[model samples]
Target chain A: MKASYTRLAAVLLMALASVALAADNDNHQVTVTVNDINELAVTGGDITLIISSATAGQNPNQATDNTCGLEWTVNTTNKKITVATNQSSFAHTLKVQAASVSGGTAAAEVTISDTAQDLVTGVATTLGTCTLNYRATATAAQGTQSVAHTITFTITAAS
Target chain B: MKRILPTLAATAAIFLSSLGQAADVAILNGDVSLTITTAAAGQQPPAVTDETGQLEWTTLVTDAVKKIIAQTNLAGPSYTLSVRAVNISAGDGTGAGAVVLSTTPADLVVDIPSGIQPLDPGTCTLRYAASATVTGGAGTDNHSVTFTITDQ
Candidate 1:
């Protein structure tokens, strides 16, 4: 009984000491806001939130630099669009617009590079747009989540 | 340094996954080169009174066709290929009667013949036994037929 009393007294003393030495929690504040806003090409979400085809003044159709999908980039790497299903990021893009075979010989690619990656491997940024229209029968698809060609042109060149 | 937080993160850790992809199906939406041919080979041509209804079908096989070349892509469940004969410029009683064409190893869904199998894709041949009744024309004179085989 004497030994038990001694242990209890020691624990009590330690608890008091810890409370006394505790740092001020008033400065230890936390705030969380949804700022890493990333947009997805949803079906009926934002009308502008789509894989749109550039009109007469879109980016280069036959690009000299490397890119996929209309050469879009993310503002923050913190947030990412999780393709929950069997949605292929590069495979799911709207790229049938690249089927246009005129002006110059053409090629196409859909790539996922490291710079624009959020999930390391899922659907990252455009690694490289398909750049070889050997068969030129192109359609931008995400597994099966895709629409029809959003662009058209007359053919003069062969690729 | 601050710890990251997202209340509406839907799920945990906010990781992303997808149907890890590689686009393989190629949809070449260009003008497909459509070619038509016939299987009636060896040139065992039929003879008639007026003119030889060869490619330049002069005296057509009245009740039958000599041969035809169907130009089409519809494989099966489409229209069956057919070619009939009638003298565009006909005499009083002489005219192209009826013509018939078929694919060898005949099936309704005539698959375009790939040369791997020796069967011809299509054939146009005249059934001499089935004749177009012709009594008297300007003469035992000649004529021609242009058989356009089609799946339309």
Candidate 2:
């Protein structure tokens, strides 16, 4: 009877050890998630495209060097920068052209309308500076009423 | 003596049966953990100085995988998971240093809870894409994402 009891105790101890080992093997997995980021910045807000007193002979009143200028610095992380005007038509025709860019290429003289325009289109990952120039065409009817238009800039991922 | 021996054998059998019951009663509590991952690694969008310049971060559901893994030992109880932004730094531009984080399937509220079945404890996983946008000053913007889990 004593020998039988010793065998039973050993079996119970082994069972308990196995259960503890199994519990130790169980794991609860966790994962941390963050997504890709692409950010952009532009210096100088509310650009004043001042086209001084115009003469009809001038046709298109071009802005002086410091008169109508804006600079944009963007980190286009594998994306392109698109430009557009808020409305299809304004009191006066507004034209925007990139004078120079620190990196990549810029659009030639493009008239702003409802449609979107491409300012910078490439996969560049550095802060790029782009110089912009604005021009306006005023008619005798549409005098110096000080018309204002909102220009929108958009960034899109590369295909 | 012979009758006493039979009684001893019967007592031992009863003790062994009790041990078996104790083993069957072993229970493990369920738990869950969540993590946010990105494919772009360390690259972050440039800081904005004005509204015209916008910063955008996008990820496919497969790439971001807002992962949530949960396990349970008992049936009938469900686990709820939710996430949100904790802090945002300052910026001069409009909506600058602001974080607009959103999940696809638009789970603005609590998501579907992980359900456990009878006689079986199991684990469940959920994945989704996250997108964020901010516009503001040219500085290091700070923010955090919070994840919470509850049982119901």
User: For each candidate, what is the lDDT?
Assistant: 0.22, 0.39
| CA lDDT, candidate 2, residue B24 | 13
In candidate 1, position A3 carries an lDDT of 54
- Cα deviation at B93, candidate 1, in Å, is 5.3
Docking class of 2: incorrect
Question: Which number leads on TM-score?
Answer: 2
Tell me the lDDT of candidate 1.
Answer: 0.22
Score residue A145 of candidate 1 by CA lDDT.
Answer: 34
What digit string (tens of lDDT, one per residue) describes model 2 on residues A53-140?
6565655465533233333333334566667887765677777766566544676777778787777666364445566676667666
Per-candidate TM vs. native?
Answer: 0.13, 0.41
Residues A1-159 of candidate 1 have per-residue lDDT tens digits of 555455545555555554443221111111111122122221211111133343464431321221222211221232222111222333433322232222122333323222221111122211111121211112333222343322211111111
